[model samples]
Each structure stands twice: as C-alpha cells, then as structure tokens.
Target: MQDITLASAAEIAAAVSSGTVSARTAVSAALDKIARLDPRVNSFTDVVAGRALARAEALDAARGRGEPLGPLAGVPFAAKNLFDVAGLPTRAGARINRERPPSERDATLIARLEAAGAVLVGALNMGEYAYDFTGENVHDGDSHNPHALGHMTGGSSGGSGAALAAGLVPLTLGSDTNGSIRVPSAFCGCFGLKPTYGRLTRAGSFPFVGSLDHLGPMARCVADLALAYDAMQGPDPEDPAASPRPAEPALPGLETGIGGLRIAVAGGYFARGGDADAFAAVAKVARALGADGTVEIPEAARARAAAYLITSAEGATLHLDRLRTRASDFDPAVRDRLIAGAMVPATWVERAQRFRRWYRDAVLRLFESVDVILAPSTPCRAPLAGQKTFVLDGVELPVRANIGVFTQPISFIGLPVAAVPVRIDDGLPLGVQVIAAPWREATALRVARALERDGVAAAPAAILS
Candidate 1:
C-alpha cells in the first residue's frame, strides 16, 4: 500500500471508496505518523486512537457491504482543543478547562465532517482561550512550526497549521476571531479558510469573543479546504449566531477560475507595514491573477483597533466567572489581558461596536466594484518561538498584538477569506488572503484555487528528520 500520510484528503477518500485502500489503512497511517512525529511538533494534545480505529473499521465494513461512501471517505482530521470531542474535555488551551468532564457530544462541525466520512484522530493544541496570536501556550506548550521547529506556528489555530504542514493529517478545524486561522496558515505554510462569521455552526465549541468568533478548516490543498468546508455548511439552531442561509458548496465552482472576477490588491493600510516578504507574497499572487488595480479600505487602522477592543471586552465577558476564581490557573498573559478587559468602559465597547457597523458598511461598498481583494495573511513568516518584538515599517512592535495587522480589518466585519500559502525560495512560507464579500466564500475560494493551479501558491509538506 502507498503511504497514506502523504496523500491528499481527496486522493485518500477516492482510494478508500474504490477499495484500493481500506479506511482502516488510511486512519492507521495517520495515527502512526502522529505517534512517531508529534513529540517534535506537539500538534496533538489528545489522540483518539481507539475511537478513530473503530470509526475507520465501520467505514471499511460499510464499503465492503456496497454502501455508498461519503466525499471524505476515510480522511483523518483533527480539531483545535476548543472544539468538543466526545469523551474528552474541551481544553480551549487553558488549564482550568481541563478539569471539566468529558463532553457527551462532538461539536457540530466535527459531527458534520464525520458524517461525510472523515475520521477524527485527535484534538490539537492552541493558544490559551484563543486570545493569542503567537502559538505559545503556557499550559500545553507551543505548537512549533513544522518548517522550522524553533519558530512559532501562529495561533490559536497553531496546532491545526502544524498538523497539516507536518502531514500528520490532511485537514484540521480551527477558529478565527482575530486571524487565528489565517495567521497559523501563513506561518506554517498551509491553506486555511476563515468562512464569514457565523457561516459555520459554533455549537459545542468553547467560546472566545462570541461576536467575532469563526470556525473553519485548514488543509494542504485548496480542494481539501473546500471539501471540508462543504461538508460542514448549513444552519444549526443550537448556535444562535449561525446563519439561516442554505449551504452553498464551493467545491463545484472551485475550478471555475477567476476570469470574470475583479481582483485588486489592498493599498493604504495593507500596502505598508511588515517585512518585504509579506508584500512580495501578495504581489506574487496579484501578478499571477493579473491583478493590477489597488483599492484602499478607509479607516482600516481604526478598524483594527475596534476589533481589538471588541475582542477584549467580549472575551472577558465570556470568561468573567472563571476570571474571578481560577486566575492563577490561567496563562498569566491571557489572564492579564482578560483582567484588563474587565475594566474597559462599557461606553468604549459601545463605541467600538458602532465603529464596527460603520466599517463593515464601508468595506462592503468596495466589494461592489471588486469581486475579490488580496492582502497579506500575516505581517511576516514564522518568528522564533518566544521572540518578543519585530520591526514593522521600521517601528518595533510587540509580535503578538501586531501579527494579524492585515487580517484583522478584513475579519473585523466577518468577510470570508481563503489564506493561500506562497513558498518563497527555501525560506519559511508566507500567506496571501483572498477576500470576498460576506456570504461569498466560493468567490474567495475560486481565486485561491486559481493561484494554486498557477504554481503561485502551495503548501508543500515540511521535511522532518
């Protein structure tokens, strides 16, 4: 049998469906890889070995009985620890949450993926409470970048990115409130989708900034990202914030290309800041897609500031009870931020919400003339783990607060974005965001597929000794 670890989710599924490879074989390969390599990568916090094997066997038996297989068939995937996996505590990358009893049910997205024939192998590590931009977790340890183990993987979707880059799993589920998904994708060199806020059901997952939170998939290929995304779409009454809109599959239109799409590079706030590699990556994708037009998003700097204020206030509100009692059990950095948020004047939060409404309206108007917008996913590539500050536009800034400078303004209003990795020379990978209007995920994904096909974007597996 071929090494299933190296195969894409689509290839693995097709092989399993065709009886060329059993579901058990595919799941076992992933489990074996995780066992052998996770010590160095620290991607998985909890491996559901018995559960995965049982699920795989059931799938193989069904196939043998001539039952129709789902699109994902036997592809192995993992979710951020925030996502509830049956029989395990939803850690949310916090030590306090580990004391909670195991969940009785899987998160809606997890159930949706399993229904589509994807096997869940484990829960991956993340930054504490999804409040971090750097992958460092004082509780679970940092999820190291696969390309350079000494560097960060980005967070709070850090493990999701690391797992894909290391080829431990073809797909991962992560949440992006403030670029958690896209930042990791940029640092670890993988494709990630941050569907519009509330696009995917958030039920059964631990909350972090409920108003801004979004859950989506990450993968080594654009097709796998779309496949996982398609499987998880639709309404869930359990999540009050979930969209009532019907599922619109992106896979079918993924290869339609970007012929009619009005693609433009983001200017003003996006054009400046960060290392040259960040701009170069965006320029590469823009050039590949024949995007010469530049559009400015007005007041983008204020938009980011508003996003931070909203995130802090909402996140603190959600964890008020815990913050009141188990303060010492928390990561000091995350705990301190939440504590500070508790003191944010309600008037300030109200002002931020008002600005958010205005910003969303202004940005959506830009989409009227352009089908898609391209920007850098992160300020730069992976920084060394524990590194404090970096110079952006010649100004030294804290790494954690500024890593998502380009991404915050877009997600601030819940825009659907597809983060595509652009590998430059032999250095770590940089990512470019393909942004689309609200509820237009397919449009953004289509552009990402175009870049992937044009050899301008890719997520090559990192070589590990």
Candidate 2:
C-alpha cells in the first residue's frame, strides 16, 4: 500500500486496470500518506477523504462491471485551492475568499481529470491569489519543501510542488500567471507543464491575471504530465479565452524523441541573473540532448519588465473592490503590491500591452529556426522558508518579486513549457524549461522525455520522516 502511494499516476492506473490493485487501495494509500506526511509539508489545505473513498469505490465497481476505465484510472490527484472543488470554498489563497459560499461544481480541469479516472483527494495550498513567486502564504502556514523542511516551496503553486515531491500525490493541478507552476516544479523537483495559454479551459477556477492566467498539471514524471495534459484538452464554451484548437494529445507523440528537431539553448537574458546551479542545470540538460546551438531571444529583459507591469495592473483591477473593502484581510505584502498596482498609470499599462504584442511576435520567429528552446526554470534553488532576500549576480533582491525572473517572460506570451527537474549534485534539484512554440506542447514533452530517458532529469521523491 505504501509503495502504491509512491507509484506514478501511470503505474497506479495500469495496476488498477489490470485488477492487480483495487482503486480503493490506491486511493487509501494516498490518503494515509497525506495524513501522515502532510503536516510537515503543509501541502494540503483540505483532504477530501470521504469523497475520494466513495469515488474509488465507484471506480472499483465499474471495473467489476467490466466497464472500460479512462487512461488515468485510479490515480490520486489534487489541485491548487483556487480551483473549485465542489462543496469547498475556492480559497484562492486569500483570507477574504474564505467567506465566499462553497463552490457548487468542480473546475473544468478537475472534472476532466475525474472523467479520465483521476480522483481528486483535496485542494492544496498556494500563494495569495496566485500573485506570489515564493510559495509562502500568510493565511495558511508556509508549504515547506519536502526535501529540506526549512526551504521554500516555489509559489504560487508551491503546495502543488511540495505535494508531488513529498509523494502526497502523484499529480496536481496549478495555475501559472507568471511563474506559478514552473517555479514550484523547479524548487520542489518535479515535472510541470504550463500548456499554451488557452489550450486548456479555465472555466471553473478563480481568476488571477485574467489575460495571463494559465492552469496546467505538475507531476513527478514527464509521462504523468503528458497523461493529464492529454486528458484535460478541449475547448470550454464557458471560458471565453479557451482555445478553439482540438485536443492535441501529447502522450501519443511523447516518445517520438527529439530526432530531426532543432533544439537550442536560450542565451542572453536567460543565461544570466542566477546562481551557478541554475545555469549548471540548463547546461546538464543541454549536454544530454546534444544541443550545441544557442539563440538569443530579443528583448527578453524588456518583456519580463512589461509582464510585471501588466500583471500588476490587471491584478489590481481584479481586486480593486477587495482592496477597497478588505485590504487588511490580505497578506500585507500582497495587499501592498496590489495597492501599488492600482496606482500604475494607465499609460504604463498601455505601453506594456503594446510591447507585449511586439515581444510575442519577435519570440515566435525564433521557433521557426528551433523546434524547442531550453532555459533555466528558476533563478536559483529554494530559499529558506520566510527568508526575505537572496543575492543574485552579486546584487541582493527581494525573493518574492524576483523568483519568477526566468519564467515571467516566457509566460508573458502564451508558450508551452515543460519544466523537467535536474539533480546534478546532493544539493536541491533545479529544472530546465523545454519551451516550444504556441500549440507545440508535444515538441517540449518529447524533449523532456529524452532528458528523462538519459537520466539527466528526474524527480526522486523526498524521503520524509
């Protein structure tokens, strides 16, 4: 049972589908592990034991009836708290959202995963309203890195990262506006995919940066990330931003390998502004893939700056009422930032949007030459929990604001990125971004699969007491 808890989503599904393991057993193992290990990790904000058990029993009954199960059969997964999990309030990691009524339905991604036979065990913790890069949440106690309890779990999908690293669940759903998803994956040592913006539906989740918000899966392996991404593909009428593109199943083409594909290392901005480990991780992955070419993304630094302005402006607009009525209810840091955002001049936001379009066009042109681009996922490894500052390039900077320095520009324009963990030494693991052109998730996943096959990138579960 304990072993089942640590198995990948693909492995558990195969076992359950073959009757070698019952769905109930798989879910129970996950529940028990969460109960035992989650206290220290603080990954879960809620544990839906009864709902999970009941769903598992139903899956078992379906198997008994000779009914075919979906690809993710019997897998236990969780979502960041911003995603609605029927009967629970969509916390969005904000103190004030706790007063809202319970959600009446699951988010689109959650429902899709359930349809694919993935059971949702609970809602995980996150940074307030998805604005944070560090995973610390003042409302809920900080989510500790499973590998080193005192270290930070990258946010705003911090809990999602911690849970996978701690083996609390094989998969989790998280939203990425800037670096919410990839940052955590890098810091916590896991595989995370931020699908092309609008590739997946955002219908039932709480809004952060509406234009920039993206929701995707995080897992310990590239296979699981592809599985979840394949299952959740499709357009949602309820979400106006949902892409109209048909489901491009990444799992089918995941192992096609990166043969005959032009892969390059991202130079210039991506190459600088981090500790040695960050670049080392990218270099290790580049070597594994035989990637000798490098491409300098034009104006990447400017893009990151523009992303911040847009995020602050949009986030402020979304929470203006809350900022007006419940300012004291927020994490003071988050509140103050949002307040500052409200004051951003309209001319600045307009200029940022105009630059965003130009930047997107310039970056997309690079994809014509290279099928995939590799870059560091985070500026550095996880910092100590509650630690306020870190020195990057010999200059001290606020940990929260700069943590997403590498991730923001990529996400600023909706590109698909697969963050694969690389552990080069005994120290904390780092990640390399396998970035592809819009709607080219398979290209990124294929590259990630190659790295995994070479054993250069892997997410080994943390051994927690």
Candidate 3:
C-alpha cells in the first residue's frame, strides 16, 4: 500500500483539492506522526498541534466558502527555528535567546507559504545559531537521523531533514550556510534545494553568515520541491539581499530529459575519500544521467580553505557582542567557531571576500560549458552522534568543517542545488548534489526529477525503519 506519510506534497495537495482528504486529515496525520516519533528523533523543538488544527480549520472554512486558494493550500509544513512565527521566540535552538519573547509576525518565507495556504506545523530544531554541521544541538538535544537513528543527521538544518525523513512532515524549511540544508538532506535521504543566494527573499528570518545563508524547501520528491520553490522566489524590499527577479513557477518544462545537457563530473576535492557508499551513489547518478564529461574545479583546496575563513570571520562578526558578554550561553562546540571567526585578522577577511568574487566568476566559467555539476553532498553519510572527527579520502577532518567540502564552494558562489538522496548499503541514507547556475532552481529541479525517474531518489521511509 502507498504510505500516507510517503505521499508527495503534490499528491497531498491534489487530494485536499479534490476532497478525497481534508486539510484537517493531513494535519492530524502529521501531528500524530510527530507525537509518536519526535520523542525518539528530537526533530522538532515544539509541535504546535493545537495551533495548527485551528489554522487548518480556518483554511477548510475558507474553502467551504468557495474562496480562491493557492497551490499549497491545506499542506502541512514546518520552519527552521530561525524563522519568526507569531507568539514563538524563534529561539533558533540557542540558550542565548531562550528568554526572548514571542515574535510579532511570520518571517517573509513563512508568511509567503501561509499565504499560499500551507499551514505552519511548528518550529523545527537546528544547530545553535546555525553554526554546526552535526545535528547535535547542545541546547535542544541531538536530532537523531531517523533514517539511521544511530547516525548523525547533518547540521544546522538537521531538524528539517530529520522531521521530513522521519515522516513528520512532507515539506520543511531549512537554511544553508556552508551546506547546512544540503548536507542534512543528503544524510537524511530527502530532497533539499538551496536556491541561489538572494533568489528567494530572506527577510523575517535570522541571519547566519548573511552572505551565504539560503533558505529553501526540503521534501520527499522534486516536483513538490519545485512547487514550494516557485512560491518562495521573488523580491521583498525589506530584504536588500533578496533578488529583485520575478518569481519563477515550477510547472514549466519540468520533465524534459537531459539529453543535450552537459553534465560534468568533478574531480579533485569532490572525488576524494567519502565512504564507498558515497562514490557508489555518485556512480549511479552518472550512469543514469549519461554525463557528458569529467571536469575539475581547479584550486579546490584553496577555495575550501578560503570559504572556511570567510564563513568563520563573518559569523563571528555577526555575534561579537553576544560572544563577548554571553559566551557561556552558546553551545561550547560552536562558541569556539565564533571565537575563531572573531580572532582572524581584518585583512584576511577582505582577501577572502576578494577571492570569493574570483571564485564566483570561475564557477560561472565552468557553467558556460556545462548545464549541471554533480558531486557528493557530503564526503560520507552521517557520523555517530557526539564524534567530532572523521577520515575522508585518507585525511582526518574536524567533524564540524569537513562536511562542507563539496557543498560550501558551490553555495559560496550563489549556485542553486538539489540535494538528492540515494539508497544506503547499510540501511542509512546517502545523497548526491546537483548544482545549477544562479536563478536556475527550475533547471536543478528538472535534472533532479530526471534522477528520480531513473530511481535514485529516496525510498519511502517507514516508521519502523
């Protein structure tokens, strides 16, 4: 039987639209799932069942009145804790903000989703201040990889990934800064897209690095992701960072084959020692896509290092005051990252920014010859929770920074990516990344849908699994 939890967002919308299922039914199933699994997974900081029910009832009433509705009408969703939700602290999983009062309005992204008729289920968990890569939020407790409860769930957006993977919700919002969104999606075996920086508006959400933070959808399939992405794109004057481009809908040209597309397989940093499962997954994608050629992102080592420096420095600057006086309040693991960012020299920060521009142009140059770039989302599947180190391609890595190798450089340049998961040999999840040029989320989604058609997307995760 087709699992109700595994149904794609599109299927749910159609069911609700046709009255085969009520919005209330969807919300009830999701809340029931959260209630049962969340205690073990810790994917949510709070599940607002009562509030969500009221909102769904209001939406159902409007539908009964024959009022027009948007594409996502009646769908249940969750926001990364960083996004403001009325009457919630937007604590962002940090002890630092625990005492802060409830918010006055929805973050722009949340507001947009609500306007489209998606109900806010509740706030998802995340790394404190969005700083760490592992899903262990010291303040909020570790969000287990429901895909493989023993393993980690990738960072920052870990809760979003976990909730979706554990069947708590079909759609959730997560941000990527140095790969937060994609990594979690990769490990959790779900589809996550980090639209080009600024392609989707960012106001009313908390900032991570400001330069690299990107908010987008995490879901079970590509078409549904495209639906959510279509709704989130476009400009809001309040966000100077949001691009002024018109919103691009997901319906156009989505199922086309990639026959003429030049898909490049990267060497160097991207091909190194992830687990055998990582390369195995990448191999499957290459075969399915009929990739045109292999290419190298030269100077990848330097690029990765520079990206780390830039992110650390900027992140520290963002929280300098808090760090100076309220240092003890931060998760000790991330406190060092903030401190390291603060200690870097001013000149290095500027130099990293200059290099960022140079790297962006170089990536653009690569795109001139290729339609998509393929790489492992993380070097490996989620690590054991609490461990801070791993070996990749034969080198030891600081667990926090190592996962970003493939994901960060692409995101640093404002590229849009679809983190598409593959099956795991050991019953965990594995994900590979598909990156397209700026403002090309549709292109990314199209290619991801192609992969799904080829059978590389995640299987239906069962409650028992």
Candidate 3 lDDT score relative to the true structure: 0.84
**Local distance difference test values of all predictions, in order:** 0.93, 0.93, 0.84
At residue 159, candidate 3 shows an lDDT of 92
Q: After superposition, how far is residue 416 of candidate 1 from its true place, in Å?
A: 0.1
Q: Score candidate 2 by lDDT.
A: 0.93
Write down the worst ten-residue block by lDDT for model 1: 456-465
Reference-based lDDT, residue 368, model 2: 82
lDDT of 3 at 415: 88
Query: Which 10-residue window of candidate 2 scores lowest in summed lDDT?
Result: 456-465
Candidate 2: clashing pairs of residues: none
Candidate 1: C-alpha lDDT:
0.93
Clash pairs, model 1 backbone: none
* Tens-digit lDDT string for candidate 2 (246-282): 9989898888888898989999999999999999999
Model 1 per-residue lDDT tens digits across residues 1-465: 457888899999999999999999999999999999999999999999999999999999999999988999999999999999999999999999999999999999999999999999999999999999999999888998989999999998999999998889999999999899999999999999999988999999999988889999999999999999999999999999999999999999999988888999999999988789999999888889999599999999999999989888998899999999899998988999999899999999999999999989999999889989999999888999999999887899999889989989988999999999997678999999999999999999999999999889999855564
Error of 1 at 79 (Å): 0.5
Candidate 3: residue 114 Cα off by (Å)? 1.2
Give me the runs in candidate 2 sitting further than 4 Å from their true place: none
Residue-level lDDT of model 3, residues 360-436, one tens digit each, is: 88878888999898898988878998887888768788888787778877887788998898874656778888888
Using TM-score as the yardstick, the better of models 2 and 3 is 2
